[model samples]
Target chain A: MKATHIQLAHGNGGRLMRELLETLVFPALGCREAFTDASPLASDKRIPLMASDSFTVQPLEFPGGNIGSLAVHGTLNDLAVSGAEPAALTLNLIIEEGFALDTLRRLLESAGAAARAAGVPIIGGDTKVVPRGQGSGLVIASTGLGWRDAGCALDIRSVQPGDAVLVSGPLGDHGASVLMAREAFGLSSGLQSDASCVLELAHAVRDLPGLRFMRDPTRGGLASVLHEILQASGCGCELNEAVIPLRPEVSGVCQLLGFNPLQLACEGRIVAIVAVESANEVLARWQALPEGQSATRIGHLTVDRRVILRTPLGGQRYLDELAEDPLPRIC
Target chain B: MKATHIQLAHGNGGRLMRELLETLVFPALGCREAFTDASPLASDKRIPLMASDSFTVQPLEFPGGNIGSLAVHGTLNDLAVSGAEPAALTLNLIIEEGFALDTLRRLLESAGAAARAAGVPIIGGDTKVVPRGQGSGLVIASTGLGWRDAGCALDIRSVQPGDAVLVSGPLGDHGASVLMAREAFGLSSGLQSDASCVLELAHAVRDLPGLRFMRDPTRGGLASVLHEILQASGCGCELNEAVIPLRPEVSGVCQLLGFNPLQLACEGRIVAIVAVESANEVLARWQALPEGQSATRIGHLTVDRRVILRTPLGGQRYLDELAEDPLPRIC
Candidate 1:
């Protein structure tokens, strides 16, 4: 029996999952080569960063993107956020048996296109065929390697209070997209999941020595990332409610689902803590790109480690440490 | 409820898994420092290499070294085999809910002491509390990183037709010991798993330039490794059954279990592919070490990619691929 939605069958390494990846994920991820454990033994310094992560989202496919594109974007974002010049990545797929092949192919194609546009290669990866009713549809672990020189060292400690906080694009796009894609509460949204590669922005200003730190807001949304920086650098942040970017549809969907837009995850967005001297230039550069056109200055770091969010009516409140597993397995 | 053996409950990331690590794994590995995220950002010109893996043998604790020792040795071997100077490791525990905390502590103590004796520090790691009955009693992922020079690289392709093979010690000790421990096929011999860190021997000779290739006989066993090398280097292997080290009990256990000792996974042994001229010197070095007292020269390489086994009765037979998980997750 085909999995109606998220279930143990999706994650298991079986025929069901194979059909899912073959039909959904492999297509979205755009895997050109057949899956094999014996990948080509070659890596260049341009793609010196090799990172692997496994995704188990609550809902299989979400709005603006499914688990397929999310996996690709997640891996790409890791490379981009790290300041490395991403070259290529290896994808390992573990799927529950009986997943539809069409679904898997569509997802893989989407991911492949995304990767191609990002100018990164998906050279090699492995796909495990699991049993039915084991996994939901798929659980992907992609390991990416990118190249970076000593000059790319991002200092978390460099996040200074008063230094402007900027997100590459709108917040809550991916998060709201997930809720809408799930079709929960009989609701849907036109908002797109902000899942794309930041390679263009990264290379556009590879010479930007002032870019102190950059991180992708995936699980736990923009709030979680900012919180991490605050704790790491012993700093605080206060957002200007009016300036924070949010899609109209995202806001609507969040309201319908009783979810916090600030807490939703994003795949394509980048949160950069830069030196005050060049924040505007970085923002301008980001805004010039298609993926970064919606970039906005969300807030400013403070001397304290507390996080504060200002309401539309000028009310200020603290954003506490994120409750774990936000949107449970939204990665 | 003690879960002396692993159950689906161990992987739940709960109390039971904790006890296994705290009592069984940690103490066995001998880790000193509290686990953390990153292995202390490597110092100097050290090119850090980290490897993480999970072992789920049928039985909880095996003969010579249980899950605890294998976790440490496996990671250490990964770095060692890669020619990286041993430094430290971090232990990540994913245990089920009902596991005994006492067992967890005991494991941690053993892991700690082992790390100390091996001259490596146990840095910080992660512990996830999973839901009940979802996972096995314990699933451990140990990440180890060490320093290797820029020019230091071990290429499997470096193997020549005349290259010699050096077995660190006996081949089937670990596999046989696990079977004995697990009572696989209704049999048990008082055999102990040869699970120990190859660092002492690895450190004693990693600086030597002629070591062409290295691999820990895990998962797939000695034959698989030979097959891998042959395929990669376009070479073949000639094994003299008499020359290859095999414990009497290991042979007995394999014969009874309808298994081949060559295909069984091993934990402690290091299979070094080296030049014929340097093979003697390398074996001498291994023999001098306490862990390598039984070290021996096993065989030599050939141009063909096929593996040929010569039996004790002077009959020649081809060693084929293994079709089953002989010893499920022996690490």
Candidate 2:
């Protein structure tokens, strides 16, 4: 028989769920704790960081990814930005009745591989089945626990004028791909999800002496992230649109959707701040990776506490926080 | 002005949710780490026994309980059964759109107070707003981490056939109350919910060397607890139905609903096993507490490998594992 696809049955504590975990996910994630109720996390000598997030994207499965990989990536990113080495994660699934088993398996396969790439193990997890109509498709919640290398935390409040802002990859790819699959505004495009792990990028450059701050732009998008940093760091920021990287296709989608590219969500990307002298070193390290070839210097910290955007026509205007929700039900 | 009921605004990050936690819960459970994104737990000589549970009962507030108290009790019991000393807990709320602010505040107050009463603190928590059609009132997920005390464990595998079965307080109260509220199975009795914290009761019997196992009957009711013990210990059970304690009103509700009292749920009660020599002492300790006043000698463990019920008719019948879904969404 061929693969049956993911269903609620695969989540049940039966043969199907067992086989899926053992065959696909276990090898990728080191398979030690994925089946347990929870990963045993103990704080060692270093300060530990833990974060929990829930993914509620619609359609369960989407182009360039499904809910599974996104769940792993979303959580790993949270831990990475906090300057911690993600140790283990707990994946809990709330599956609606009658969900296809084959789809679930494929999602788990991708999720496990993503966790492995991030150098973290998917330890303990739980599965609960809700009756049909009570819940739709599936809702996945992942909680991550990581250890912060002592004295290596980047202070978000310590960012100062003349600090350089950097992006590890192009922006808006994730949101664009999701909208393409969702058929929102009657638009369809062949865009894949950019859901990949970023633990390596975080670890590789984490030890930089001049590093000031870092964050993963998820909900509220890049524009919101910038605004948050300004407000939090008590500093101003200025961006050069020409230098900021964006996929041509993503730009097109944003234009038609009347959405700002910077306000569009990105699943697997990083924004780092560093001293001007170390900016070249950090950029070099990021661009060396396959996922971060487009890493660019997008902006610079300003003494004035305002966010200014350089328009395509070389005009300058303050870019305020987006007043509207860009996307809901996003991981 | 008269007090208003629960409104959707309460679950918002604004005033209602804050007042609920600040006024009701924080005062009782303490203020530290209550508002943080995650509750940080520390340990020394004692190992933490972590457990989590979700409650989705239909009515937000029941006769003798509400979702708040249930979340606290459910989590503490999980730790208790593992023979751990209850320490701290995290409470996560998934509030549906339009949930009343007043109602949520009241519920949190109750939940917070309940945790304090159990000597447990509501540490970390999360809140999400789902669309109206997506949820029923609200769902609460509580994760509790407890410290294990020396000589406080009851390993099921070591249980022997001569061990005796006992129960602290009555069964069927919570289950009967749910039926009365649901108005299902032609039952509309005004039975009260038996939701209560069992931490004290669990601790009282922790030092009993004869303690073999303990469990609280909730979803599948009292019968399922017995089944779990029998399976884990590889022993049979013989239950004396005549001696199994039940409230008169709860028994009436069960009869009207065409359900057996033995198959009903009990949130605050416990099913315990001990060596016969210590059974009387354990029972006496249980009877002294107000919550354990209705405790009884419910059954015994046997090598027969079959669960049997001794009926009031002087006849014997199989006490099969409860297969019928007695009640749904009872945490």
| Per-candidate TM-score against the hidden true structure | 0.76, 0.82
Please write out the lDDT profile of model 2 over residues A1-331, one tens digit for every residue.
Answer: 1334444434433334445456644654456633422223444566555556666676567777788889888878877877877777666666666666666666777787888777776666555545556665667666666667668748778888999999999887887787777766676667776767777788779999989888887655677677777766778899998888888889998887787778777888998888999999999998888887889998899988888988789899887665534454555
lDDT of 1 at A308: 91
Q: Pick out the ten consecutive residues of candidate 1 chain B with the lowest summed lDDT.
A: B33-42
Best by TM-score: 2
Name model 1 segments beyond 4 Å from true: A1-52, A58-72, A86-153, A180-184, A202-211, A275-277, A324-326, B1-72, B86-154, B177-190, B205-211, B303-305
Q: What is the C-alpha lDDT profile of model 2 across B1-331, one tens digit per residue?
A: 1224333333333334444445544554455633432324444564444566667665667789988889788878867866777767666666666666567777887887888777776655555555566656667766666666645557767788978999998787886786677665564556788888787788788888888878777655666666666656788888887888778888776676677777676788888889999999889988888888888888888998887899899788886544434455554
Span of ten consecutive residues with least summed lDDT in model 2 chain A: A33-42
RMSD of each: 6.8, 5.2
Error of 2 at B283 (Å): 3.7
**TM-score for candidate 1:** 0.76
What residue runs in model 2 are displaced by over 4 Å at the alpha carbon?
A1-43, A46-48, A101-129, A149-162, A184-186, A230-233, A275-278, A312-314, B1-39, B43-45, B85-88, B115-125, B149-153, B184-190, B278-281, B324-326
